[model samples]
Target: MNSEAAIRAAQNQWKHRGAQRPAFALPTQPGQESVWDYPRPPALLSDTRTVQVRAKGNTAPIANSVRALRVLETAAPPTWYIPKQDIDMQRLVELKGQSSFCEWKGAATYWAISNASAQPVAWSYEKPRSEFAALQGHICFYPSRVECYVNDERVRPQPSEFYGGWVTDEVIGPFKGDPGTSHW
Candidate 1:
């Protein structure tokens, strides 16, 4: 199959399209959101809650903002994307030749804290697909790699290294990236 056809086929493999929650999904309490209820293809929503990111062992935050954009997708915790202006650009260095692609978001460029570990702690889409054009000039961090907080609550990293969803008390899940959830 051609590339476009292959992409479509792969995208179609997701069994839960988010129109309804799966049987195994945990019940959401009041003031909580179930990841299962988020839509497929994802939805980008503006968030005004304070979001913060700090490198490990650092007392100062690398990024903090109330103007974050959240990408919510089926069975995944929301990944908060902070505008470039809210981040400390001087402390970040682009990792050349390191990149990844998302079927929905297009290419991603990785970034790491300058003078710290070489491991990438964050990533951004410089030229996202039209559907996600708003994500340009925004960056998202891996909670596992850095300290991340949303509305003063610390975030837990999504279970897989390949996924960067941020988990907090407000979002409940049998989230994607956990063992045996690959088919979702």
Candidate 2:
């Protein structure tokens, strides 16, 4: 099968038999309805428009890692979503960065990674508003771009994927590549 077909079939197999999906904007009570319920809120929630990101630990060898440095979280291996203002602007080296658009978010600008003691790691977004700006200060790493370091030890990411949060240890499922896997 073609890659797209294979992916579709693989996705179909992941459906759960018992899962309660949340209703998008159903009424919680007789009178509750707002952005809280799909009602609405002020256009802007916060006055702060910018956030920053920094590389934790010593993961500066790979470009993807630096790109992942855009992640913002109080915890480590934060998802890379660094806002333009949150990043250390002086250290960044904006190459002929590429751009892409997400259906939910807006345009994304990629940056060539740069570090003080090592080579570049990855790219990041600068102005990512539209709800996702909350992802500001966070970074998402390219599995293909960097040498992942978990607790000071280099850890190889699972193959056939691109995005990852270097720190989240949540076990997803008996995914496609999981052991004892069968044909799609």
Candidate 3:
């Protein structure tokens, strides 16, 4: 089957699985961000700051840049997409044979960072939909697979496997990826 077909099959399986979402901590402090405040259908915002991603097991930064964009959606944290020019191209090797579909962004290509222990740490949309054209050639890292930092502050991975939001002190939850939030 084609990649899209495979993805659909997997999603269907996940829907059919007999599992309930679990309860999680909803700790929030003043001045932090709340996912409830984000917009629906998501909004693409310009984030001008130093963004960096390091291998999960390494201290050295594998990708870093000041030019990046952020996507904010209701019930989810922000996901940053760094420009190709500012990223360290040498460390990220492209992966093949898999793709993901986002209603707004279009298809995505995966990238693996090369460190002493590197895997597919990020993904990019070579040709984003015209509405999201700014994201073209910009890569987004998976926080669970790699450590992401914004302006030197390390980020927390979003709670779910499908959502790749880099949660920082500024953003609040209960965010997506947490137990029982899949339907959110």
Candidate 4:
């Protein structure tokens, strides 16, 4: 089977089985959160909070949207996806690179903004799977590359380059992509 097929089968298997839930969710207290509460196979939710991504050294945001979507997955921090309409498309240049496939979201392409701001600092799924249809034509930025903010709180990039989860002060984790978290 192809990678996509394998991923779907795994997703279906995990979806039905009651497992992968973190034992410790760090008590979802006021001003604090844990990644354990997030779901496996991930789920998308509409975010009313303002999301902004400022190009490096730029005072103004190159991308900003109030109607963004957040992908919540178990063991990972939330990834904020901004709508295409919210970004300055003129400053974006889609580069050719090997794309990635998400079990839930289908295929995603790499992206970089123009003006020599950054290279491959973001990605987008132009036509996502039905489960994430809302994300079509939307791009999710890497907090590590650009200054990303959600509702006035600056975000920290998820530990590594692969998973694009945004880490805020509220979300606490020995999050995925960190050293020795490969088993997770």
Candidate 5:
């Protein structure tokens, strides 16, 4: 089967197996934080880390930013919001045909992985506001898809299946059927 076929098959399987409109009970946001809004990476993240882009012959070096934004963590992986300045923008090619709709964030633009050696990676963002302007050109990576490194040591993605705060270390829970996950 072709890549698109494989993707469609997988998506179909997931849709069939997943709960029909799971409830999305987002965790309570901390004081000063909006209700399950985007999260920012810790202030201590290093810019000199040895990041890897798992695309098709390219392992582009990346500048780690202290500014990753977390959108959500599901029964899958933690979603990170990266800043465009922290990434090697040359590898992100805007995709004309891919798009995703989000009620809160708005319409997202899609970008495909362009590196030959890096594994295929595609990213999208619903329309983001000025508060999220840092993420305008940046793309977040799925810990399941991309492996990050700090110097020679590998940095692990957050462990929660239902949370996406880049600065927090606790991986919350098996929140599959939580309140508003139907659209996820």
Candidate 6:
């Protein structure tokens, strides 16, 4: 099959469509949200909360913004996409030829910090699918590789290296990307 057809087949194989929380999902308290309650194909929502990204051991943020876009998909923590304008572009170097495909979004271009190691620390969808057009010109960081904060609260990296979701106090989950959840 062609890549597009393979992606379509992979998309259809997901067992959880986000319509309801699974039996193993954690219950949310007031002011909290269950990732399971998020929708399939995801939702792109504007966020006004302060989002900040800093290099490891660096006090200054390389990217900071209150005008972020949050991508909320089922069984995963929310991924924050900062506007390109808010990022210090001079400090980032795009890793050419390193890319990935997302069934819901499209192709992603990876990036690394210029003075840091060559490992990718962030990614962006330069040309997202029509449904996720707002994501263009925005970038998302890997919390595992950098310090990330949401409204001043530090974030935890989602459980797997394959996913870049940011876990925070307000979001609860038996999140996708955890062990044995490849089928999610």
Question: How well does candidate 2 score on lDDT at residue 67?
Answer: 30
Show model 3 residue runs off by greater than 4 Å. 1-30, 57-59, 115-119
lDDT of 1 by residue, 82-166 (tens): 9999999999999999998887888899999999888999999999988999999999999999999998899999999989999
Q: How many steric clashes between backbone atoms does each model show?
A: 0, 34, 4, 0, 25, 0
Residue-by-residue lDDT tens digits, candidate 5, 21-40: 23443344343232222222
In model 1, where do residues sit more than 4 Å from their true spots? none
User: Over 4 Å off in model 6, which ranges?
Assistant: 1-4
TM of each candidate vs. truth: 0.96, 0.40, 0.78, 0.87, 0.48, 0.96
Off by over 4 Å in 4: 1-4, 10-25
Candidate 3 accuracy as lDDT? 0.75
Per-residue lDDT of candidate 3, residues 81-155 (tens digit): 988887778887888786777755678898876543445678888987677888897899999888899999989
Q: After superposition, how far is residue 135 of candidate 1 from its true place, in Å?
A: 0.1
lDDT of 6 by residue, 1-184 (tens): 3277887896798888899778999999999999998998899999999999999999989999999999999889999999999999999999999988888899899999997888999999999978999999999999999999999999999998989999999999988897899887
Q: Rate the local accuracy (lDDT) of all candidates.
A: 0.92, 0.36, 0.75, 0.81, 0.44, 0.93
Measured with C-alpha atoms, the lDDT of residue 46 in candidate 6 is 99
| Candidate 2's TM-score | 0.40
Which of candidates 2 and 3 is the stronger one according to TM-score? 3
Candidates 1 and 3: which is better by lDDT?
Answer: 1
Q: What is the C-alpha lDDT profile of model 4 across 1-184, one tens digit per residue?
A: 3376697675765422214445643556687767776777677999899899998789878888999999887778899999999998888788786587777788888888785744688998888888788889899998988889998898988988787899988887768797877556
Query: In candidate 3, which residue pairs get closer than 3 Å at backbone N, Cα or C atoms, i.e. clash?
Result: 33-170, 33-172, 159-177, 160-177
Q: For model 4, how big is the CA root-mean-square deviation?
A: 2.7
Q: Give candidate 2 misplaced runs (Cα > 4 Å).
A: 1-78, 82-91, 115-121, 148-155, 165-169, 174-184
